[model samples]
Target: MDIAARSPIGTRLNGLAAALGDGLRTHGHWVRAAQWVVVLVYSVLIVVPAVLPLPDETAHVFTHLTVFSQFVFWGIWWPFVLLSMVLVGRVWCGVLCPEGALSEWVSGKGRNHAIPRWVRWGGWPFVAFVGTTVYGQMVSVYQYPKAVLLVLGGSTVAAMAIGYWYGREKRVWCKYLCPVNGVFNLMSKLAPLHYKVDADAWRASYGPQSALQNTPPCPANGAPNTARTVRIQPVNCAPLVAMRKMEGASDCHMCGRCSGHRDAIALTVRSPNTEVVALGGHLATGWQTLLILVGLLGIAIGAFQWTVNPHFGEAKQWLAEWLIDREVMWPFAENAPWWLLTNYPAQRDVFSWLDGGLLVTYILGMGLVMGVGLALPLAGATRLLGPWHTQRFYHLSQALIPLAGCGIFLGLSALTVNLLKHEGVPVYWVGDMRLLLLVGANLWTLALAQGVCQRYATSRSRRWLAQAALLPALALVNYQWALMFWIW
Candidate 1:
């Protein structure tokens, strides 16, 4: 071991990591305790204000945006959750996710049906993500407490429903159907902490003993227990993470159920790109490419930027005028119920059909434009980098995951900052902070691009030229973000 790993603090941290992994694996009581606590706290927080009446705006006890539910949900929770993914991967999904917990708790009592092939579809996560994003906007989910209960609460219920019907084990809803699953999976790649498993050590230690009398031990004999810890069998991994092929932080939710099974898993610190760079074979897929392009780099940017962008008003007005000239006026009617759209006439808050249509077009058009901008450069990158084809193009697109990940974070953070500002909290430095983050994320993208090309491009010239091809995509994303924050 290196000097750093051997140091007292490092050793202590390692010990703690081992202990945490074991506890998560073996401490069934503790896990249930946490789930119930989350259930209680989140149930009250999400359900109460949504069902109850909103506080009277004129009755002034607190300042602007005194609605505690909205403040907590939007201002604090959303932004910090995104931040946590970057730092600790999907610890939220594994540990304190009330939705996941609820689903699992309900699923335990439900039938263990055979998982169908449709449930294993690769495009579900991407489709779900875009659907949720568009729907959330349509219903003003982030702005209203009731919308929160309606949308997020509906999702929580759906998770339970799906889990109740599908797979005998594993969080089927989380693994396949959750809108945020793909987002969390992508963001988790940037986390520095992961439980690394040595397959060789694992097999050597307990390959023969994998099937204990009562399924004792772990997945491949990894996650060795410490002296105070009793040897326990590894339980089924909830997210269905494969130990044999566990290469990145993408799939593991850090649940720790499989921590000390084969006595091979150990928590270790690494650079953020450890997984981004280590992802072998196919770097990404066409679906994944769409996710980064249309979803993250494109729609995410447009989603956060449209209201702030002056062009939105011009476009909306032009469309309105065109529709009026054509004598099609019904689209302007804001008659949709609040449950269907954002029609709270009492609060002077209603979204016309025109508004909903314009929003979809604006976001889709922005995404299409950005995706094209990226695709063209990436096409060049593929040609420069390899005996290129559709799959290779998809593979090479992984180079920009850093950029995509950052765009999503910034977009969400924008909403968070807005909520704080509404409550009269000072977020004066948000613009500058965004600029710094943009620059840092861009630099990280460039570095990752360089590394990817060097490792994959076969020759020195190809490596350099491939990186050159990726430059424009990086530049295109940076330009759009700059236009959003700095210029028109």
Candidate 2:
């Protein structure tokens, strides 16, 4: 076959793959299957354990539900969280997240401009829902009885209201509110994935280069130019007639709705020669919802296990007894536990001081390490990629936030497993294997961030420093949380 003929064949194969992926997403019946699995687990793992007399159950999973709180608890959770974010890019927002899914279902695309009367009138109920749920945890309600109803009602009303409001614009709740979304928006820096726009193609499509001047009016009727967070310059569009006439054309979700094109790809390649996209309200991907959901699920499970397990104390006692009962190679070690207490009165105090001191030291040290790390790289990125106004630092920072969150998460997980083991907890404590996994994952995540960062900040030093800077901040944050436990 001629080379030209082969090129067309390759193009056709690529298009086929893109279409197949889109078909699966558009129909999304498989996602419904996934939902069923979630439902089954919710029933079997979450509800059953709650209602029935399970021996070791005590909301062991519920604590993990609070994604923000997990930052305070364990680091092992970070790698899984990173993996989910990279795979789906926020699928958690659409399908898996119970809250977002419920919001979407209730609001019914939220495009209508008219605000629902119930939401406008009953706003406080939504506030009450959040308050009551958090308060329930603080007060140790064990289970939310009437609180579930409150959640349902408030969600319905809020969905109607926010849905109506955002429907008039685009993803209003996700951009301005939705605490979980906010976390994703902020922590997305730690993510190993980023949205890439073909700048040359976009410029060909729309000539003017302002955020407002470049893209078309949102067909979804979302907010106009203000919604452009990612570089929506005229540089990245395919010059299709319909696309060429549109301003803010880069806000296209690559949903492939406008131009009859299917080139947008989720690549294994860490970086693409393209424009960096940001969380402008006008566009969202299928994966955003997914990441949020999976993370939430993990958080819920971790929380229940960590905070509320009824058998935790008993489990610790059994572990202590078993170790004491044995008389093998380390008999002297066995006797030392008793002797250390009797002979060395200051051992406990000394250990407490050591723990607290180490935690504080890590916090300060990690902070400095991250600050210097990122600054050096970021400065370097600017020096290497400079002269063009294209390398924007702020946008790069956003993409790396999630990865940074992951690094800190791993650091904390290590510390958490350490503390749990010390307390005689029977959980799988951190070891060489898990630590290696964390390091490898975070490094890949950092590379991805740097690739994206280079496009934004031309200074080589700045890029290098910024990329390196993130880890220490994460480490410091983790250390700060660990100190809280030690202090209390």
- All candidates' lDDT scores? 0.76, 0.38
Instruction: Please list the residue runs of candidate 1 whose C-alpha ends up more than 4 Å from where it truly belongs after superposition.
Output: 1-16, 26-28, 55-66, 206-232
lDDT of 2 by residue, 268-346 (tens): 1121111224331222222332222222222322222333333444544555567568742242231322112111233
> Cα lDDT for residue 199, model 2?
45
Q: Name the Cα RMSD for model 2.
A: 15.4
What TM-score does each of the candidates earn? 0.88, 0.44
Best by TM-score: 1
User: Where in model 2 is the C-alpha error above 4 Å?
Assistant: 1-17, 29-82, 109-176, 185-396, 399-402, 407-429, 441-488
lDDT of 1 at 204: 55
Top candidate, metric lDDT: 1
